[model samples]
Target: MRIEISVESPQGVRAAAAAGTARVELCAGLSDGGLTPSVGLIEAAAELIEVHVLVRPRPGDFAYARDELDVIVRDIETARKHGATGVVVGALTTEGEVHDACAAFVEAAGDLATTFHRAIDVSADSRRALDRLAELGFTRVLTSGRRRSALAGAPLIRELAGRTAVDVMACGGVRAANAAEVAEVTGVRDLHAAPRRPVGSALTGDVSYAGVGVPAGSDHFETDPVEVEALCGIFRH
Candidate 1:
């Protein structure tokens, strides 16, 4: 089993490598489900662990405008220049089908391994979408089987795993508590997890950003090395 740790900070990158993770999906702003990480973050993480930079331009839907598509492509190029070994990217049509824009993103990635991101979860039909992604030359697809969690979507993951088109990575809501069982049921060798915990931030005093309240001393999400180690231990067993 190969453990892929989802990391958003420099600390997480070091911890993931130290904890025996095989790779790290480098991203930023996990609260918004993840956006593209900075070139600096990609370069730093790439040096410590195999980095697969997330190519998402923003939060919300996967259907992107032409300008947004351009940004994603540029980010892919920046990641490559910074020493990233692969990239995680995807796009969906307004009709919820895998978009042709994905092909452009993959091409921009050049020889880097490209894995279709979780946008597959929102596709009109996952099976058909998976087929389309395979046709696009993606080596892997990260999905939660159209559900909020991989454990909840294991049946479809198992079915997709049976197909030879591409490798299915079980993602979303994965943790030490159920990582082993999820792998057992889905028959997936690749597992993606964030393994994070809330920690107090330096910000003080009541602050609200666009009506959302931030407490005097806010809290931020940070990856827990112990959690990563625990999850990796399950796969090793």
Candidate 2:
């Protein structure tokens, strides 16, 4: 099985590479479920490991406006220019179906590999969305089978994996503890995870740079190389 880690920074990419991960989905604001990474981050990550830039413009739903689609297309182009190995993207219509505009994203990517992101999980019908993605030239897709976690969505994931031409990558709340079980139950060869741990900030003060409801001196999260190694060990064994 090939393991793909969701990484937000150069350190995360280095950690994943050190642990022998196959690839990384490079992004910013991973706490917001990932957004497009900066050009520098993409270039830096590409040097460390195979990097697939996530082309999300913002947080919230995948249903995007025309401007957002344009931005996504532009981001895809930027990722390519900055040395990204591939891109992860998706879009939905108001009716929760694959948006026709996603074609522009693929067109912008040119020869780069494309992965339809977790937006498929929120589609009205994931199976139909999978078919549409395949038609749109997406070689892979990341999904939790429309459930909160891949383990809970194994039945649907297995069903999708059995018939879909596109590669099904089981994601959402994947960890070393359940990675093997998820793969076994879903019959998927690709798995996406973020083995992150909080590192306490050394700067301690009453002033805080975090968003609302976040505590002062909040710790930042980073992908732990040891955790990545543990997850990789499961597939290796």
Which has the greatest TM-score? 2
Off by over 4 Å in 2: 204-217
lDDT of 1 by residue, 111-171 (tens): 9999999888888998999899888899889989989999999999999988766899999
Steric clash pairs (candidate 2): none
Model 1 spans with C-alpha error above 4 angstroms: 202-218
Give the lDDT of residue 137 in candidate 1.
90
Error of 2 at 210 (Å): 2.8
Question: What would the TM-scores of all predictions be?
Answer: 0.93, 0.94
- Tell how far residue 188 is off in model 1, in angstroms: 0.5
lDDT of 2 by residue, 33-91 (tens): 88888998998888889999999999999999999999999999999999988999999
